[model samples]
Target: MKVAVFSDVQAVLPALEAVIEHIEAWHPDMVVMAGDLVNRGPDSGGCLALFDAMRREQGWLPVYGNHEVWVLRCGEEAPASEGERDIRRFTDLAWQQVADQAERLHGWPDHLCLHPPDADAWLHVTHGTMAGNRDGITPGRSDESLAGKLPQGVALFVSGHTHRAHQRRTQGMDVVNVGSVGSPFDGDVRGSYGRFTWRGGRWHTELVRFPYDRERAARDFETSGFLDQGGPLARIVYLEWERAELLIAGWRERYQDAVLRGEITLESSVERYLRTIT
Candidate 1:
C-alpha cells in the first residue's frame, strides 16, 4: 500500500495545488492531511474548501493543527486585553473566512492511526508530538527526548509543524516529518510532502519536494486582504514565506512582551523588527 501525507498548507493556494497534482499522479492508496490547513497566510477559506472537496470526493483523512485550534479559539473566546486583541487580529481575519464551517473544522481529529493489512504495527499521524499540536518533533531533538513524544506500539510515526522534513529510526520505530506544503521554514521555497510505501512487511518513506508558483502566492497576501487587514503579525507571516524561514518565534521572543505590556505599539514593533532583520 502507498500513502501520501502533507501538512501546513497555511492558505497558499498555488503551493497546495502543486502538491495535490503531484500526489494525485502518484495515486496513493490513501492520503492524509496532517494539519494546519489554514491560518497564518491568506486564503484560508480557499485552502479549506479544496481540501474539503478532496475529502468528500476521495478518501483523504484530515487532522487539525495548532493553527486550526487557534482559529477556533479566536471564535469562541474573546481576547483578554486590547493588546491581545490587536495581536490576534490575523486569526480573527481567518476566523471570519471559516466561521461558517466551524462544525467541520471542529470534527477533525488531532491525530490518526493506520493499520496496514497484515502488518503487526500501525502508523501514527499527528500534526505534532503526543505532548501537543504545537510541540513538534524535529531533527534536532534527541532520541531521549523523542521517547516521550513517540507513542508505544507504532511502527511508523508521521508529523509536520516545524516545516522542515526529516526521517529517523529509533527505539524500534520509524518517524517522518512531512514538512510544509505552503510555508516551509527550511530555506527551501518548494512545497514538500511525504510518500510512504508499505512492502515486505515494513514502511519505506520519502520526503518529496516540488516547486510551485510562489510569485502568485506572494500576490495573494495583498490581494486577499490578509496583509492589510491581518495586523502586524500578518507581516511577519508574509516574511516567513518570502524567506522560507521561521520569524514568528524570534519576533515573539523580542517583541511580544513589550507589545503585550503596551510598551510599544504593534505596528511600531513590527517595523522595528523588520528593520533589524533586513
Candidate 2:
C-alpha cells in the first residue's frame, strides 16, 4: 500500500493548491492531513473549503492540529477579562474569517491509524504526540524522547508540528515527520510531505520536497488580512514565509516570558521582537 501525508498547511491557498496536484499525481492508496489545515495565514476559510471538498471527492482523512484546536477555542464565547480579550482581539478577526467552518472542527478526529490490506504493519498518524499537539517531535531528538511519543505496535509513527521535516528510528519503529506544506521552519523553503510505501515487509519513507509560488504566498500575507488583522504577531508570520525560517520561536523565546508576566504588552513585545528580526 502507498500512503501520503500533509501537515501544517496553515491556510496558504496556493501552496495547498500545488500540494494537492502533486499528491493526486502520486496516486497513493490513502491521503491524510496531519493537521493545521487552517489558521496562521491568509485564506483559512478557502483552505478549509478545499480540504472538505477533497474529503468528499478524494477520501482524504483529516487529523486535527493544534492550530485547529486554537481556532476552535477562539470560536467559543468571548473571554470576559480585558487581558484575555486583548489577546484574542489581536487575531480574532483573522480567525473569524473562518468562523463558519469552526463548527466543523468539532467533528474532526484527534488521530488516525492506517492498515494496509492483510498486512501486519500499519501506520499511526497524529498532528502531534499523544501528550498533545503542543508537544513536538523533531529530527534531532534522542531515542528516549522519541520513544515516549510513539504508540505501541505500529510499524511507522508519523507526526508534523515542528514544520521541520525529519525522520528517526526508535525501538524498532520508524518515526517520520512529513514536514510543513504551507509554512516550513526548516531553512529549505519548499513545500514538504511524506511518502510511505509498503515494500519488503517494511514501510519505506521519503521526505518529498517541491518548490511552489513563494511570491504569491507572500502577497497573500499582504492582501489576505492575515498580516493586517492576524494580530501584532502576524508580521512575523509573514516574515517567516519570506525567510522560510522561524521568527515566532525567537520572538517567544525572548519576549513570551515578559508578556506572560505582564512586564510588557503583546503589542510592545511584537515591536521589540521585530526590531531584532527586521
Candidate 3:
C-alpha cells in the first residue's frame, strides 16, 4: 500500500498546489490530511475551495485539528462582545465559504483505521491528540512514551501537529509525523509532505519538500487584514516567512509559564496563542 500524508496547509494555496502536484505524480492509493486545514491564514475561503477540488479529483481522509474546531465554535450563534463579534464575523464568513468541504471528525481516532486487506497491522492517524490536550505524541517526545499512550492494535501511527517531520520504529511498529504542507515550525520554510509504502513485509517512508510562491501567500495576508492584527499571524506571514520555528518556540516559552503557574487554563492558553498567530 502507498499512502501520501500531509497536514497544516492553512490557507497557503501555493503550498497546497505543490502538494497536489506531488500527489498526482505519486498516485498513491490513499491520501491523509492530518489536520489544521483552515482558520489561521487570511485565505480560509480559498483553502476550502482547494480542498473541495482535491476531494473531487481524489478522495481525502481528513482529521480534525484544533483550528478546525476553533472555526466551528466561532461560527456558532452566540452573544458576543464588540471585539468578539468582529472576530466571529470574520470566522463566520470563512466557515460559510467552505463549510461543505471542511470534513469534520469527532476525534483523532475517527481519521484512521486498518486498511482492511492487511489485518496483520493497523494504521492510526491523528492531528496530534484530542482538543485541549498537549501531551499527545509529537516529534519532541520519546518513542517509548508515545507507544504507551497509543491504543492497542496500532502498528503504524501517523500524525501532524508539531509541524515536524520524523520517522521512528520501535518495538516492530512505525511512528511517523508527516510534517506540515504549509505552516511548518521547522527552520526550513519549504513546504513538506510524506509518502509511505508498505511492500513485501517492509515499510518505506519518504519526506518530500518543495518551494511555493511565498510572496503571493504573503500578499494575500496583506489583503486579508491579518497584517494589521499585530499578532502571531503577522509574524508568521510577513516577518518569519523563512521559518515558523522561532515563532513557535517563542509561543511555547511564553505559554509554558502561564500553564505551569495555573494562571490560565490550557484551553484558554491555546486559544490565546492561536488567536495571536492565526
Candidate 4:
C-alpha cells in the first residue's frame, strides 16, 4: 500500500493543486492532510472547499492542526473589550468569509493510525504530536526530547508544523516530519510532502518537493483579500512568503508584548520590522 501525507497547505490553491497532481501520478492507496490546511494565505475558503471536495470524492483524511484551532477561535470567541471588539470584528469578518463550513476543521481527529494488511505495526499520523499541535516535532531535537513528543509502542510517527521535512529514527521508532505544502518556514519555496509505502511488511518513506506557481500564490495574497482583511499580522505573513523564510518570529519576540500591552500598535510594529528588512 502507498500513502501520501500533506500538511500546512495554509490555503495556497496552486500549491495544493500541484500536490494533488503529484499524488495522482503516484496513485497512493491513502491520502492524508496533516493539517493547518486553512488560513494564513489567500483563499482560505477555496482551500477548505477544495480539501472538502477531495475528501468527499476521493477519501482523503484530515487531522487537526493548531491553525485550524486558531481560525475557529478567532471566529467563535466573543470580544472582551472595545479594542478587543474591534479586533474581534476584524477577525470575525475574515473568518466568516472562509468559515461557512468551519466545523469541518473542528471535526477532525488529532491523529490517525494506519494499519496495513498483515502488518503488526501501525503508522501514526498527526499535524503535530501526541503532545500537542504547537511547536511540533522537530527534525534535529535530541533523542530524549523527540521521544517525549511521541507515543510509545507505535512503529512510526508522522508529523508536520515545523515546515521543514525530515525523517529520523529514535527510541526504536521511525519519525517523519512531512513539512509544509504552503507557507514553509524553511528557505526553500517549493511545496513539500511525504510518501510512504508498505511493502515486505515494513514502511518506506520519502520527502518530495513539488514546484508550484509561487508567483501566483504571492499575488493572491493581495488580490484574494487575505492580507487586506487578515489584519496587521498579515503583513508579516506576506513577507514570509516573499522571502520564503521566517521573520515574524523575530518580530514577535520584539513586539508581541508591546502589542499586547497597547504600547505599540500592531501596524507600527509590523511596519517597523519591515523597514529593516526592506
Per-candidate Cα RMSD to the true structure, in Å, reads 1.0, 1.7, 5.5, 2.0
Per-residue lDDT for 83-141 in model 2, tens only? 45555553476467778766656788888997878797979999888888888887777
Model 2 vs. true fold: TM? 0.94
Ordered by lDDT, highest first, the candidates read 1, 2, 4, 3
Candidate 4 lDDT: 0.82
Q: lDDT: which is higher, 1 or 3?
A: 1
Q: List the lowest-lDDT window of 10 residues for candidate 4.
A: 82-91
Please name the candidate that would achieve the greatest TM-score relative to the true structure. 1
lDDT score of residue 263 within candidate 1: 93
Top lDDT hit:
1
Task: State the lDDT at 31 in candidate 4.
Answer: 96
- Across 65-161, the per-residue lDDT of candidate 1 in tens digits comes to 9999999999999998778998999899999989887676878998899878887678999999999999897779888887677889999999999
- Clash statistics: count for each candidate: 0, 0, 2, 0
Ranking by TM-score: 1, 2, 4, 3
Pairs of residues clashing in candidate 4: none
Error in Å for residue 10 of model 2: 0.7
lDDT of 2: 0.83
Clash pairs, candidate 3, are: 232-276, 233-277
Per-residue lDDT of 1-278 in model 3, one digit per residue for the tens? 88888888876777888888888799898888777777556677777677756766778777777667767666565624433443344455556656765454234333566553665667777777423223445666776566455656667777787777877877567877787877777788888888888876656778888888888887777777655553333443444445566464555576745654666654465567767766
- Candidate 4 displacement at residue 133 in angstroms: 0.6
Better of 1 and 4 by lDDT: 1
Instruction: Measure candidate 1: CA RMSD.
Output: 1.0
For model 3 the local lDDT of residue 46 reads 76
* Candidate that beats the other on TM-score, 3 or 4, i.e. the better one: 4
- Cα lDDT listed for each candidate: 0.92, 0.83, 0.67, 0.82
